[model samples]
Target chain A: MSTNQIFIVDDDDAIRDALGWLFRSRGHVARLWSSAEALIAGGEIGRCGCLLLDIRMDGMSGLELFEWLRENGHDIPVIFLTGHGDVPMAVAALKKGAFDFVEKPFNDNELVDRALAALDIHHQRSSRQAAAREVDERLAQLTSRELEVMERVLAGQMNKVIAMDLGVTMRTVEVHRARIFDKMGVRSAVELAQLLTARTPKPD
Target chain B: MSTNQIFIVDDDDAIRDALGWLFRSRGHVARLWSSAEALIAGGEIGRCGCLLLDIRMDGMSGLELFEWLRENGHDIPVIFLTGHGDVPMAVAALKKGAFDFVEKPFNDNELVDRALAALDIHHQRSSRQAAAREVDERLAQLTSRELEVMERVLAGQMNKVIAMDLGVTMRTVEVHRARIFDKMGVRSAVELAQLLTARTPKPD
Candidate 1:
């Protein structure tokens, strides 16, 4: 479960209240904002899983707020509430990576489904991000010499060969390898290699 | 460069001709079709990098055509040509993974720019798909026993330890390791591991 809120930002009071009730009826926790500025100052921007924003707000439209979020490195999934004319604006926002948009006369069930999908994407993205951070933290604990030994170990090098290549004694190479495994919190070279490989770039 | 043709599917002859000139003016080879049915029958799909499709046509609308392409496993990036009334339909198509939509009365330069971006995405996607297929082919060539040896070798096991664990002679283990490396087309265990790792699921 994401444990993140779904945000609904619209200038219209009726739309906001309706959307809030709509999300709540479907067992989702939603935070409603009367305007984009109100949402920005609400101090809950980056913590949300999904957003349903009115595309054509009075000041600082939904598209502008989405740009702001991207500029500040927030990648929250956003579904827009669009008027007939606002479809073009929605298209532009989608190109900039807004998740999806719903035209004004939206079906309650359909809107709920889209929001749930957005939340699922957020869940996946956040989990990968969390995993990457954990890997980074464990990697940061290793000394340069230990990292070098770990690389050789990952390459299936025998300790004797690694020692010879590094111009170090076999005993010193073994000590470095042990510390590398300890810092990486892996029981074997295979486990350490798997973790590190997942952090590397994909094949070109 | 993708070296793939850009497809333009629209019902109106004038629109198709205008778009053809616009694309050629931007140094792209575009194949134009009078309708969705015409484009489908043309059979140049599954190879194109991008498409400009009018949202509404006399028969087999653009959305329907997009659905057909998806069901048939073609993932071409499509930019929709949408009239005012077709905006909602365009939004629905986008939700179904249509790349981007340009409302009717579009700027030729902007449309050309979006099409070029779609081509770039296609290049990256096709490259990755090619890499994955190559990996699968190599893995398929290995026998089950060689695969088992390959796993331990990737784990950085010494030949002596692997032979003992697998109840095999040291010479036999060395042969299997060499065969695994040779079959995978890599000189070292690290290169082999990196190639295989990219095919696995991302970190959870």
Candidate 2:
């Protein structure tokens, strides 16, 4: 059982206090922030597990804060708490990668469920990102020429064809192929193709 | 301007013809199969993209076919085309990882949109899975003792602390840390932590 902290960001003192109490009663550590600015100013961001953000806040709106965090490379998952009129905005946030949106006066269980789901997703995203970074690091080990060979292999070019295309001898291609396999640690072309197909482009 | 192929699998010739025409007119290459077995036997599975699978069939039920493919490690994205009374089965398919479920007599545009979304997701999933395999391969290069050290370092333990815990000399810990960084092609502990945290465990 993972113990996760929840950060509640809402202007309404009553709502924040109530949620904090509720989360604490459920064995979660809940921290209440009166506004997005307060949460940002506090600079205690990474400690909380996930965020419960109100759609409409005074200075920095929830959506704006979300955008800010995303641009700055913070991938903490957020679940939006929205008023009835804010459904469209919340939906837009979902498209922009908000985990889930709960309408105002949400069922307590439903909100908790959404929060838990958001945490699960955040965990998954974090895991995938870590894995991606590892791949990037390994790919960095290849020499420029070896990387060229890899690109050809990933593009489904046969070794003889790659040798001809790169104007290298077949033996050279074979040597590079062995090195590529050793460096990438892939046993076969199919596995290598699978890896290439799934690689996300590194940020520029 | 992403180009994707759509595969329509159904026993009904009319539905297949209709969907094929619809997809083709929208600039997609649509390939029709008369049955799940036919589609599998055709061996054109990897060529023309996302699947439009009909739920009810004579030999293999769409759900069963989906489960079989998934079990065999195929990640081809599928959108279930169901009849009116098959809504429950469709829902169950969605839970089982079908990209989307649509009933017959569905809006043409809606189907197209869902198919497009499923294709995009399939591409992303395939890419991510490939990248993850690369990470797994690189991690596999570490010796058992090195792996234990790497795990502790990634968990944010200092080298001295790790040495004490592992009952190794501090100099030995330093040697292991250097080898880990060199093998993993990582420059810093923070980056290594990020890499380790981002990996998803294979499903149990």
Candidate 3:
């Protein structure tokens, strides 16, 4: 049972207390904030998990806080708690990048479920990002000539064909191939290709 | 066993035949094309699969083909097959949206494994897209007032609170709530919130 963290930022004490208790009862780690300002003051922006925020807080609206998080490169999935007449704002937030929004008087079970789903998304995104970073780091270690050879090798080109294409000797291509394998820490071309294709580039 | 489809668009007969045999042996369905023109003429855009295209073809270059695919909204993951001295072009293609590129004289096993992985990516992307479409269709069914009520109700607001916030009678709010539920085909606020949160919106 993973104790997924749930962050709640609402101005109302009762609402915050209710959410905190609800999440805790369901085996999640719950952290509460009285308002968006308090959440910002706490300095936990990059924490991996889900954020439950009230759309119309006293100072620094949820949308404002959401923008700040995004601008600062925080990818925490946010579910906004909207007040009456805030549907348009919530929809705008959805378009802007909030994970989802629940209106005030939301169901405890639904909110908890959504939070869990958001946490899962965060985990998937971060894991892929980590894998991509690893690939990028390994790729950066290759020289231009070695990189060219690596691409051809993964394409299934033999040393002779690669040599003919590059107008280089077969021995040179072989040397580059060996260096590429060593640098990428892969024994076979199949392993190298799998690493490159396994993770899609992160969306902009 | 799932026979994932692999699309091979290369002018070289030997290369295409080799890739086709390799993928088929690995239990994948391989479709071969001699040129980008032939692929476009076939009208197979938007198909759920992966594409292996040669970068420098006879008539249409791989980069040109990839741009055409993107312009027409084809999301097929494309892996380019480049010839000697095509590393620069391959790197440019990768930056421009091609999945990954392989050099000429490519490895059969490496290419096959990469194609399989790309096919898996296509499947995951398309399924998520289908789910987002479902949610958008459901959301479109609600009226403005009903949408407002729906948002608030999903926020867990009571009828009385919603009525007070919307400056409407409690009975009116209740009527709108019933109509919203009927339109959205959901029984409770929890169900509604879950339905809305289940799919992330497609990125622009």
**How do the predictions measure up, each by TM-score?**
0.82, 0.50, 0.46
Our tally of clashes for model 3 stands at 15
The TM-score of candidate 1 is: 0.82
State the lDDT of candidate 1 residue by residue for A131-178, as single tens digits: 878999999999988888887888879899999999999999989988
Task: Say what the RMSD of model 2 is.
Answer: 12.7
* Residue lDDT tens for model 1, B1-204: 444789999988888999999988877889888888887887778657888899888999888899899898787788888776455665677767887888888888888988888887878777777787899999999999998888788777888989998999999998998888898897777678778877784432
Write the candidate numbers in order of decreasing DockQ: 1, 2, 3
What DockQ, between 0 and 1, does each candidate earn? 0.37, 0.03, 0.01
Residue B29 displacement in candidate 2 (angstroms): 2.4
Give the runs in model 1 whose Cα sits over 4 Å from its true position.
A1-4, A45-47, A143-177, A187-190, A200-204, B35-43, B148-174, B200-204
- Model 1 Cα interface RMS deviation (Å): 4.2
Candidate 3 runs further than 4 Å off: A1-3, A35-41, A164-167, A202-204, B1-204
Best model per lDDT: 1
Best by DockQ: 1
Error of 2 at A110 (Å): 19
Backbone clashes in model 2, listed as residue pairs: A127-B198, A130-B198, A198-B127
Chain A TM-score for each of the predictions = 0.79, 0.79, 0.80
Clashes of each: 0, 3, 15
